[model samples]
Target chain A: DQQVKQNSPSLSVQEGRISILNCDYTNSMFDYFLWYKKYPAEGPTFLISISSIKDKNEDGRFTVFLNKSAKHLSLHIVPSQPGDSAVYFCAYRGSTLGRLYFGRGTQLTVWP
Target chain B: EAGVVQSPRYKIIEKKQPVAFWCNPISGHNTLYWYRQNLGQGPELLIRYENEEAVDDSQLPKDRFSAERLKGVDSTLKIQPAELGDSAVYLCASRLTGVADTQYFGPGTRLTVL
Candidate 1:
């Protein structure tokens, strides 16, 4: 069974607009959540993260919100640029072994 | 600092062949991880190492897959008698001591078993 899920397969947004990606988890053992962005034929790069203690975390134009009760989280990018176009994946840090359970991932396209 | 490096960015071999991919992590980083990613899927950890010791490898297919991390800096993943279903991207990542929770990923080695 997949512990983390990203229902959206793809999303398109205009440059300079807000882009929101959503993720859900079925495991309560997760205490840390991270977002990674990946380009074609490359490895994933860390974007932002949020701990279970906080409901929100922001860095520059990127912000992540987590609702523990809902078992849901979202990543928001304001003034999204073409460079932000890539595949976004959500991962949960397991309390045991510190392993990460990743979602299927969402492909985002920011049209210039 | 230079990022994680992986060699043989792309490889194609017929089924039942043995293939190996190499990786060099960032300087001074002691933790290494190997992950597999399929099309439209996220990365799945196959093995994890802490300073040359494999701390976790429960997800690895022992019958045909094996990995090694020597000197605690570089790693190799090999698949013997690869099957057509083994086609996927093998990604390598590394981090510092007690910092393996957050990783820096390599470009990955794409493998296609015909």
Candidate 2:
């Protein structure tokens, strides 16, 4: 069973625009959500995270919004740049084991 | 400081062959993790180690997959008589003992079983 799901497989946006990636989860117990960016042939790197207690968290151009009622979260990048093109994964930390449950990732393309 | 290091970035072998992958975590990081990522899917945890002890390995396929983190620094994962379905990218990650959410990952080893 896939606990986390990213319905969109890919997204395309022009530079200087906004990019939004969405994720949904089936479990309500997940309290922490994180986003990771991955380049080709490289490992996923941490981007932004949000706690269940907060509805939104922002780091620079990246922002994550969580909605407990909808069991959904989203990562938004304003004024997206070409360098922001990569695969983005949405994950949640397991409450008991601290392990991560990840979505099937969304490939974002920021074209110049 | 160096990040997590994994050797033999790529490997290809027959279904019945045995293969091993190695990992060296960042200095002073006592936690280590192994994950397998299939095509078009996110990574799934195989095991987690604290120091030299494996604290979580419920996802590991113990019948053919085995792992060891000796001396609490470097680690190795071995698969014997591999199956064709085992082809995937294996990733290693590490974090400081007290860190809760952040994990640094290595480049990973891509394995192909023919």
Candidate 3:
């Protein structure tokens, strides 16, 4: 069973628009959530993260919102640029051994 | 500083053949992880090591897979009698001992078993 899920397989947005990617999880015990951006043939790189204690965390043009009651989270990138086109994955930090549980990932395309 | 390094970026072999992938984590990082990602799917953890000790490996398929981390710096994952279902990209990641979320990853080795 997948503990984390990215329901949307892909998302497309115009440059300078906002791009929102959603993710859901079945486990409530998780406290930390992270987003990673991956380019083709490259490893996933860390984006932004939110702790359960807070509902939102923002880093530059990227913002992540968490709704614990709904067991859902979303990543928003404002003024999305062409460089933002890539696959994005949502992961939760495991409380036990600190391993990461990742979602299937969503491919984001920022068009000019 | 160099990031994680993995060798044999791509490998192709017939079923029942043996294959090995190597990983060298970033300098000073004590935690290493090996994960396998199937096509169109997220990466799944196969094993985790804290230094030379494998702290967790419950997800690894021991019947055909084995891994070793000697001297707490580099690791090797080996698969014997590989099956067609073993086709996937194997990724290696590492982080500092106290860091909980940030992990540097290598380009990964793409393995194809025919």
Model 3 clash pairs?
Answer: none
Candidate 2 at A27: error in angstroms? 1.0
| Model 1, position B26: C-alpha lDDT score | 93
Candidate 3 residue runs with Cα over 4 Å from true position: none
lDDT (tens digit, per residue) of candidate 2 on B1-114 = 888899899999999999999999989989899999999999999999999999999999999999999899999999998999999999999988776678889999999999
TM-score for candidate 2, please give it: 0.98
Worst 10 residues of 2 chain A by lDDT: A93-102
Best DockQ among the predictions, by candidate number = 2
Per-residue alpha-carbon lDDT of candidate 3 for residues B12-103, written as tens digits (9 for 90 to 100)? 99999999999999999999999998999888899999999999898999999999999999999999989999999999999997865688
TM-score of chain A of 2: 0.97
- Which scores higher on lDDT, 1 or 2? 2
lDDT of 2 at A42: 87
TM-scores for chain B, in order? 0.96, 0.98, 0.98
Error of 1 at B57 (Å): 0.4
Off by over 4 Å in 1: none
